[model samples]
Target: MSILKRDQGGVPRADPLGDAAGTTALVLALNKPVYPVYVWFLAESAFQLSLLTALSMPLYLVVWYVSRIGNSRAARLGLVIVGVLDTLAIALIFGRESETLAFLFACLVLSGFAFYRCEVWLSRGLVAAIFFLFVLAESLIGGPLTPITAGDMQNLAYLNITGAAALVAFIALRFPRQERMG
Candidate 1:
């Protein structure tokens, strides 16, 4: 009886996007560290600025690629390729100016793949951990490579980690779910 009434329904319905318990919270957390640093100083050096852009832009592109590819496994494989390149790139960033950042660019592309494949906290955590080390390395030893300002580097780290987290969240929410397709 009451079941047929539109106005008097019980639980009614749930909104999926709103159900994202922590999307706004997480996005806020991710954006925090970078904004203040922006006020402190601009990007330290051409090299560091290049490094951040090199890492982020390619990733954004590759994610678009993964979406078109549509198969999750295929996307995972792409991520693997990107990961391998990233490993090589990190080595080069410290090792030499020309090759290092380029290779790291490849790695960021793979990160998109990880975002596509991973759907939970631990998966995202692994990516975050790697990023933490990546930034810490840039801070502690990067001065040897070229002149970059400390404030710039801090901002870079904030942007990188937060951006990466945001990437994972976007991937989780927007990806096509076959289960939901029907």
Candidate 2:
């Protein structure tokens, strides 16, 4: 089924602004890596950041777009996998002391949103589980907790922002399915 399709009653439903608002809030809440990325992109040469963003964002979006429209079990599993990878990336990027606060905040916000909005308990549980798993894994990896340097920020920023996008898309795909069924 197309992600755009309406209910069986054939009545077109207005788009919920809450979803957009939630997505924006989620994106904005994850400011730790994003702020640094933006600064790095501005402070240093823009070529690499620009190039990476252009190349990566579209590919990520396409995966999300396809996942939204495709009901195949594989697509659903893929969203879960992407969701896991995104959180893992966040943990790796923000494992330091100064950044850890932001990381914890982002994780709380994302998981809380998922818990509140996701109709399926399975989805909610999966999100929560993966988040804690990554946190624990990062702790076990045992790197010194320090602030991100400008050089590290560049790559981390890309990962953080794009990961947010992927996370949004993953939720979008999962949450809408319950509405359609009901």
Which candidate number maximizes TM-score? 2
What is the lDDT for 151 in model 2? Answer: 59
**Overall local distance difference test of candidate 1:** 0.40
Q: Each candidate's lDDT (Cα)?
A: 0.40, 0.42
Candidate 1 C-alpha lDDT tens digits along 103-180 = 333234334334322243434554565566556544453332554455555554554445555545564564334312
The C-alpha stretches of model 1 lying farther than 4 A from their native spots are 1-41, 47-72, 87-144, 176-182
Error of 1 at 34 (Å): 16
Candidate 2 ranges with C-alpha deviation above 4 Å: 1-37, 41-59, 67-80, 93-95, 98-119, 141-182
Task: Give a tens-digit lDDT track for model 2, residues 3-108.
Answer: 6444453322332222432433343334434544654654343323322322223333444444344433333434344434544453443443213223333343
Model 2 residue 143 CA deviation in Å? 4.1
**lDDT value, residue 109 of candidate 1:** 32
Error of 2 at 52 (Å): 7.6
